[model samples]
Target: MTSAAPHLSILDKPFVLDLFAGPGGLDVAGHALDIPSLGIEWDKSACLTRYEAGLETLHADVSAVRRDAFESLPPEINVLAGGPPCQTYSVAGKGAGRKALAEVKRYIERLMAGDSDEEIDKDLKNLSDPRTALVLEPLRYAIRATRSPNRDYRPYDIIVLEQVREVEELWKHYAKVLEETGLPDGTKYKVIVDVLDTETYGVPQTRSRAVLIARREGLGEPSLPAPTHRAYEAKEWNRRRDLALAQVHQSTLDEETAPEPEARQERGDDLQPWTSMGEVLVTPVGTHPGRDTPFLVRSNYGSSSDPGRRGVRSDQQPAFTVTGKISRFVVFQHLDESIVYEGARFSMNEAGMLQTFPPDYPWSGTAQAQQVGNAVPPLFGAHLLSAALGLPTLAPEALRKPWQPATEEQRAKLRSHGCGAADDCTARCPRPE
Candidate 1:
């Protein structure tokens, strides 16, 4: 059936099964597009958040799930999308990819050698690796689903996987293996892999991920969606400075003149500029209670000058990548005209907005910040899945509308009902002046 929304069609939309799903970003996107989807997530906190968000979730390790569970589904899932826990392969993880990939390679070898799970578990027991061979679980599911021993063997028609940029080479290995071994139907997969920046899809955060898209032979290969926003660049810094100067001048000229929305000047003709930090902050411009000023906290006492170190982005620029350690990134807030950096970290709500989750989204459980940081922005995930489904692309304008924050009553409900514990909730929930 066709969707009521202008950008989606559900007539041929595939049922999606997302493995290692964190906080239901892909699942949320699927729901938004009217595609049926289910998520498999093992983290208790994350699963609770999924439950709170009203997304279907199965709490279990990807390695432990059986294939029959998927194969017997009534609608028969045709799309498999997931982001394996990528810490082992992220650059931030200190060269863990090399060691982790070696383990994955060995796991693949064991599978090829007909080693039983008990045999493999015996050898891998002590590894307790955050996700040593876990990334291979999706591939295992794909292969077994296609090569089932039953009379009705229907392979997953499409697979979309993502990880840190460092994992690209490992995904290349997967592609190579798939190329050599055709499916049970004896048809090879057409694989397309790339490193995509989340900002390109209008996500306010400047995060990059390694993406893998594969279609079983006969289905047309789908291209990655074109970027709807310009990536953050060195040149944009100057534009931000000029705009800040104009706003300062305007404020100086007449304090009563409301500051022009900092966001309006950042837009362009065809491609909208990247979503900015100012656009998504909880307090609107000139309305912040304390000092109404914000600044970046780039580093601490002995940070060793890592450029990737968490820092402040101008209101005109997109936010820095939101990492699992997002709670530590300080946001300076001025109180009584005195800047205090003690506890102004971005709230869970603000962080969620930076990742493009809707304002009213319910986030529950203990690890709220990590779940938000780990999630693929659902809006962007929708774009990727939509492209995979061969649906018409939505214009940048449609996706780039202004973000709205949850109201005070809504925020109160979230806080009183015990949503995830936010690090700087005290700073975030000061009595509205």
Candidate 2:
């Protein structure tokens, strides 16, 4: 139990558990907000990263974790936050894309049963469900154990779920499960996309991400906080300039401008493409004559890899989605002096800064670039939490920062030391600082 002297003038800090916390990006985000974090990650590297960052890490697969794990924590954990490994929905390669998305849905199904609705519905067997009976059995047990006879108040008041766009339907499904299972009767669980700009949050990159939020019953619908940055048209959404909880500054007209097809079933132009790589990735323009890394020297162009790829644009338009694979695509390749980081090098920390991590935040670990690529941006979490608590997010520092890029000499030195040769290593990340 963490007790504080009343004279200290601080409320008991909210506790957060990061499920499938890869590389502690979510943990850092919550920690920056001053929340106590307990992270569960199956990957050893991620666990080490979380541990190094001064977080409590449970080095075990979340699937293997049970309710017994919760008993080890101090009661009164106010928040549950994390994005489970998103292998199931990611549209990648031979592409073992997002494998967990289907599993999450199955997990939700099992945990969603109620006191009276126990009649297992049929026909669900054919469909692949992530949140299945097997996956969510423990959560179901946790809910059942908290019934009238047992006084286990296992009700978590808030949850910050971060997932992909395809998972939006999953949100509605999750909402339904919570309602039918009576999880939301006394709790408030809602999911909304809080797309905070990395640049606005003082990160040099123009990255974007989504956030999902939930509050235990009686806390009321959690506040959906607004963005602070305006880079790449985000600032334009500040119609009223309500700095406290201002929403994204983008025009909803882009959405309204989208010609609604005469038919309702048609696919819409995918929401104006997210901030692209050309806007963030370091170009090779200023790179040393001989120190050009593959990423640094890539052409300033899109790819044939995409269904209908667009070529390079001299105008700094959104380049394309910056996936985990940057050197392969989503990069400004070729030799040019004007590329963003052209001829210049970027550190893992610098990449993270573009991803919107706080400067003083020690991201201790090797394979820093890869770690930065895989993480969920922390500012997105900050925006969501700030919204839920109705707290002020007037900090200007979180929205913008000076860009940091590696010099040719530094890149040459690192390459000489064998750090540049193996750019694509799947090995474990180093300990977080």
Candidate 3:
């Protein structure tokens, strides 16, 4: 399933270069937007999944790839996006928080002290701590790309970085360096680094991530995209009313086939409420039909449910954040008004779908569930690129509709903004054939 070599000529226009590309989620979204892209990754299985999906890829460790090697890329590569592995900064991880932070600080101090790349890399390698330093690789590539004289010191016009919420402080530090760096034209990038809730952007799951967006001044101010869905407020719910079993799904779910449901019912302010776990899991095949309706049963890896943890998922509410260990998520069928459970974990496909990957997407890899859980939802990726490119984003239906390649008109509009170009070429350089 390795993709054919990409048309090198396509690089004549603006394109995306994704570092640490896991399973090509960002590249998929970029392709759907008609923007050609390439991903640099090191994981064998994740790379296999990317190739199976027909995504162009480079199976190389991103840290080892020299930025100078990218000189051949068109100068119109205004967008540089990446999501470095976040295990070290994840709240759930075992990395010593203070020690990791100190290590990062020491690394930064070394860089500021003009330590050689060889020396810094040697130290990092000797530490045997991959998570602590990988988070900073994106910034390394950015600095290399912008500071390389061989490329005339060209800079990415737009940069987007994402990681776990715990890394917001580190991102803020990176923002300072980015803000101080200037393009050849002496224009500085406007940078904003903040923590954003994925559900507010219409992701079905309630995941919060640290996001950094920067614009090479004049494109517009650096800003996070406004939320497209209603925010989840647990306190706003009246448990007696919101959690009542009688207040189940308005749309009838099929028992046998469990086909995809219709459009979402609108909530307050004419916006669709957060997508519910029931909406995502109830209808896909392999879901067990409970007595009359399906309800969620949350439990750890144990066979018996814990009263403190086991809870029912209301069809009307969005799911809690989906984690890497999806098998831990057990669903129960209410039999004769009693909760009866067998091991019914969300299938790999179901997990990917919940992450907003296309339903029929051919997901490959040994760690399928982990890949799906770690990926940025393709829908959210599309929105992010849309925001970065200053293009009108898709409707919420992006979750259900198959992605269509961008059209000539769309390319024209993107070029009009001087995206990926040395100078504004709105009138010159017609759409590539």
Top candidate on lDDT is 1
The CA lDDT of each predicted structure is 0.66, 0.46, 0.64
Candidate 1 lDDT over residue span 1-433, tens digit each: 1112335433365888898899878887786667888787767678667766666666555665553354433347789889988776765665555576777776665654456656866776656564666777777777667555441667778888888888888787777666666543455677877888988787877788888877777776556767767677645566656666666668867553423433533454576667776666645422222213455533221222475544455454577777666666666654543555554666676677778776545677888989998998887888788767766654433323333434555444443332233221332122223
Residues 61-147, model 2: lDDT tens digits: 454444334454445555666665444444432212234446556656655544332433243344354333332332343353344
TM-score of each: 0.75, 0.60, 0.76
Stretches of candidate 1 exceeding 4 Å from the true structure:
1-11, 67-75, 106-130, 149-151, 234-269, 282-310, 334-343, 394-433
Candidate 3 lDDT by residue in tens digits, 1-433:
1112222312235588888888877887787678888777767567657656767665566765653345644555567899988776765666654357767866765564456778887788755466678876766666667666656787677788888888888778777755664433344677888788877777777788888877776666655666667777665443434333333443255222222222233344754567766666555432323222455546343222333554445445566666677656776655554656554566776677678776656666588777887888877787677766665665656555433333445434433332233223322222323
After superposing candidate 3, which stretches have Cα over 4 Å from the reference? 1-13, 67-76, 109-115, 125-128, 147-150, 181-187, 237-270, 283-293, 299-312, 401-433
Which candidate do you rate higher for TM-score, 2 or 3? Answer: 3
Sort all candidates by lDDT, best to worst. 1, 3, 2
